[model samples]
Target: MVLAFSTESLNGLCSDDQLELLDAIDHLRLQGIDHYISLPQIIVCGDQSSGKSSVLEAISGVPFPVKSNLCTCFPTELVLRRTPETGVTVSIVPDSSYNSTENGLHKFHEELDGFEGFPDLVEKAKVAMGITTLGKAFSKDRLRVEITGPDRPHLTIIDMPGLIHSETKTQSKTDVRLVRQVVRSYMKQPRSIILAVVSAKNDFANQAVLNFAREVDERGSRTMGVITKPDCLVEGSGSEKAFISLARNNQVNFDLGWHVLKNLDSETQKGSSLLNQRNVEEARFFSRGAWKELPPSMLGINELRKRLSDVLLKQIAFELPSLIREIESGLDESREKLKELGEPRRTYDEQRLQLLQVSQGFQSLVEGSVSGSYDDPFFEDAQSDKGYEQRIRSVIQNMNKEFADEITAHGHRREVGSKSQTPDQNPEYVTREVFLDHVQSMMQRTRGQELPGIFSPLVVADLFRQQSSPWEEIARGHVKKAWDSAVKFLELVIEHVADPSISNSLLEKVIRPALKTLLTDAEVKTAELLKSHHRVHPITYNQEYAETIHFPGSHSREEISNIVRSFFGLSSISNGNQYLNNNNYNLSRLVDNLSKRVEPTTERLAASEALDRMLAYYYIALKRFIDGIAIEVIEQKILVPLSDILSPVAVFKMPAKVADLIAGESWESRSKRQDLTKKIDVLREGLGTCERFVSSRLKDEQNSQQEEAAGEDLDTSDLSVGIPTASDTEEAGVV
Candidate 1:
């Protein structure tokens, strides 16, 4: 499909079916249907000084304002309709974003008797679009000029801002970016058919239209190249060769192919009438030696319209289903947003209900989190990397396990030191000289105060104090970690369940204060629990101590009895007497060996029993402390009080300002809700129309195919009314 014209051309013979479809599409455009659902359309784009305005004037039969210095700064959507009367009107149709600014300024319009007043109207449009100062600026707002004439085609074309290369006094870098953004916005629409106009005078190297078109419409499937000013090419030059190559599709291939339209040159346009411009175009196409051999269908403005109409119809047929889908998707998204915003907040009762709902939801979340149910959505959201492990019950359970392990490990710290064997080899350990030294020190301090073998109460108290010194630090850390986790969980629950309107205030006025109080109370209670353990320095005997101290055999009893008697000097053992009588025995050396070996061993074994008794009782008390804090301090003081205090603060009495905020929607939110509702209606309506159109078109095509297969006459009853068998503008003139 290189589209090289043949000797004979297919001109003025396009089917009435194609023209009818274009007319129906134009009817929808006249109703402003594209604002709701994007329809397949022809959008003309080119660079500055690319003969874009000339081409538009030739195709549209309207004299657009063509300035030598400035390009059109806004999109101009020209909707041409063929009617019995001849008239034109220009109006500004702001985009959806401007719906709230529906003042008279945005709705301004002017009727025109002819093209004589159009240039001034364009200037006015510039000012209305906020380009009041002498600067290069553009707008996304559309200036729609509807022309109803006996000579107009049933077509809609949008003329976008021409791409600029560099900055000048009026146009800065911002203007360059602004133009590209504006043009790309239109070109990027999936349903837009890009009419990329390039001039034959410039080398294709400088033409950016082709590059932009390729960027958005890769493969050039929906882009049609319109080569204007073909007569401007010099004879026998590199530029001439490039123009011919593009026109012949030998370079830069396009699916729709290149179309060479010889519009009236500037000199010719000055003297020629709008009707005579066509005559001039035809004369040049036929008389020019370079273009004379090409097919008439591939030249001139008249054929371009017919070709565009055919292409637009086919495109509409192809994209209708997707357009419906897009519209439906938008509708669904709007509904979801409106749902999240909840029912309109307007009255006191409504506000009260909203607050109550939030409170109830928060309560449910807190309860679920502590109980580990995770039934509520808040906990469900917490099932992620961000401290999901910090759930109330989960954190407490893990901390308790870690605490028990820590305490168990601490009990064996002495045995695992450098001098001792591993616990697996033997669990028995001698506290030995450490306790003996403490008792001796106590005896020296309590001289003349206690009888022999009887420890002063002060000795027991000092030993207990030294052993239990680490409890306060450990208890404080445990309470703080658990409290912090509870507070964090509370914040998460509030954020998840409560509306933004109340979350901040509730946290400030209710949750934070109550949580602080609970933390204070828990800290005090924890200190007291550890203090109680330290206060009762009881040295009472117990069955566990007896079990810890008893030796299992008669040999252990006799050995212990001998060591006590020998060390106490109540008697020398018989073996020692036998060694003393031997001539090899030295009495002083024997005495030194007995004092070093025998006495320390006896004292060590006894000290080990006392140490074992003390630690056994201490370990039991530590286990009780861990359990008591978890139950009484963390759960009872912190977790329970947090929930109880928050309920009263959040549910019972809200501030007057907060009540008003919850009861009523903000102006911005109300505007957004209204806008969405309106757009939803528009989208739904457009979707219905497109659905019906597609259904009818498919049914007609099916019937036509069936009739041909069955050898019967085609049915044309369901199609639109057929137009006159003449040129589109000529048909308009006939009326």
Candidate 2:
């Protein structure tokens, strides 16, 4: 039934101030602020053919096309505004799930002065949204119908596509999921008051809308149950009684309670005065039947309209404060995004300046990181690996300590019994005696014209080279690890200081090549440091070497004596006097000759001496190598160059064309900046609107209190003296 437009029909339902508040929110919604923040509104949702569109039509007094077998395929938003004249405008708000440009959904708009062509407009909207019986079954796009008339209440009600129970030939499983997704998206908004429509012809338990409502608003704080088609139930039947109980809020109770309405039957819909006939039949059916027990507030479309209006107002009031806070937060985030994108670098000069700025920031952060001065906010998350990686000094120090420990534990080729071995000692180690036996074999093979006690000095160099072989691989690995950390830190700094487009170009054109060069230089320097020990003769003047050298105490005098006897093929004598008394030898002379003999024992002693010198030299060289890697290669070659890789001087020396290529904005960056700028503007305006609303509300409250105080001080005698009270002024039409 089409409701008439007149000034007296909808006036006094809400105060002018409340209407202003609703209008302000509506204005923000139209400006697309609702995409960033949820706005307060009534959303009608239910299963297919659940009379949801009927409820919307009853409240809005606009003819929403409804059929017995057909169901809504898209969301329809009815925005009713109170104005002096009647007007209507139809438009399409393209669903965010689809690209408006590709779909051409943003091009649909129509204006009308009346509702005569609304049904045809609805058909056109469906076609525009690509909804058809054989083709698309549903859409996420919204068909917005703004109705402005003198009698229309200031409200907005959205009628969403009904939920599907299962898939059919026309509606696939994808359509069912899409419809649920669309319904749940609206219900989940904190500011939306859910009007869950349930048809009385079906069992409430079978309907899924209430379950969805409870899922989103579990407490039912913002959900109201609306039972439609009450006249369809037979009087005094079990179904009618159950619906009556539901209308009384006894069955399936909600915090917002339940409402019931009777929509126009098919026969009544074809006749004139459809609104009057439907209202009369609904009232007559409820006035004397079991439904009479229900509250009047829960019956009829008029009371439902008032309840929805009040519910929306309270919801808006309850959410406005947090809404303002959300807008402020959104504004801050957009500004930060814009700042990260930086100023547009269109010209060569501007691009050069941008690169210089980025270079300055990169150099500053690198210097702080390399020097162990982690005072920057970026280094605050020290517990995280990213933060730890950025602290170059700490990472390098840990790496150096680990390198030294590895060398100490695995550096020696043999384990001497004289010294205790580390827990992590290399498994390839052999006893000193076994090592010396191998050394003696080598010595016999390389025996020069020299005496048995003396051997080639090259033997010591060979032993040292083999002992320190693991050093080069270990040092190279450590260097590579430190280089990786430096690269990670550089990438993080670039990302922080510049846009993605600029950062990617800078890394490709400048930072990567520079780092590659530094890595090669560091590796070469590390190899050179190892070469000095590998190719050259053992050389160390440190006094610590002399202190470290000690004879192998595990060797006994008997072992040496046995070796000497075996080498000369001599038998053991019963007494030492037998050899001394021989005419060929004198006692003192024989002892001196035995001590000076170039026997196998002399060769063993030479090997032992060589081993002791090698051990001492190894200790000294290990310390020197560790220091050289940490200081000369890691610090000087890699880290030191990193701090100046993107320095101001380097940026200044760069050609303008190269700087432009590295720092110029790309299409994505420009689009992102533009989007952020528009968002910032919308948020600022929304923030101002909320602030003005709050200020005006507070001023009104203060004025109300002051007037009440004045009224309280009034007396009969004061009125007689021609002093007008607030009530008196209002009665005289002066306020």
Q: Give the best candidate by lDDT.
A: 2
lDDT of 1 at 277: 48
* Model 2, runs deviating above 4 Å: 1-17, 46-51, 65-71, 82-87, 113-117, 149-153, 162-181, 184-190, 196-245, 255-262, 265-299, 322-355, 368-516, 529-636, 648-684, 712-735
Per-residue lDDT of model 2, residues 1-735, tens digit only: 233432332443454545766777877776778877889888999998888876766665555556432237877788877679888788889987656878787888888876677667777888888887667888889888888867666767788988999998878999999999999999999889899999998999899998999899988898899999988899899999888887777877789999999887653374234655666777887687777788899888777867776777766766776787789889999999888787888888888888888898898888998889999876758898888887888988898899888777776666655565556545255676788887787777767787768877877778788778878778899999989888888998898888787899989999989999999999999989999999888888898776556333313333454655565465742324434334432333343344442325888988877776776788789899989999999989988899688888998899887887788777777767877888898889988887776666556556766877888643323112212234433343321
User: Which clashing pairs does model 2 show?
Assistant: none
Backbone clash pairs for candidate 1 read 150-732
Give the best candidate by TM-score: 1
* Whole-structure CA lDDT of model 1: 0.66
Backbone clashes counted, model 1: 1
Query: What do the candidate models score in CA lDDT, each in turn?
Result: 0.66, 0.77
The digit string of per-residue lDDT tens for model 1 on 217-335 reads: 98888999988887787766777767777877778888988888776665444422443545465666556666666667678776786677667766765565555567778889988
TM-score of 1: 0.68
**TM-score against native, each model:** 0.68, 0.67
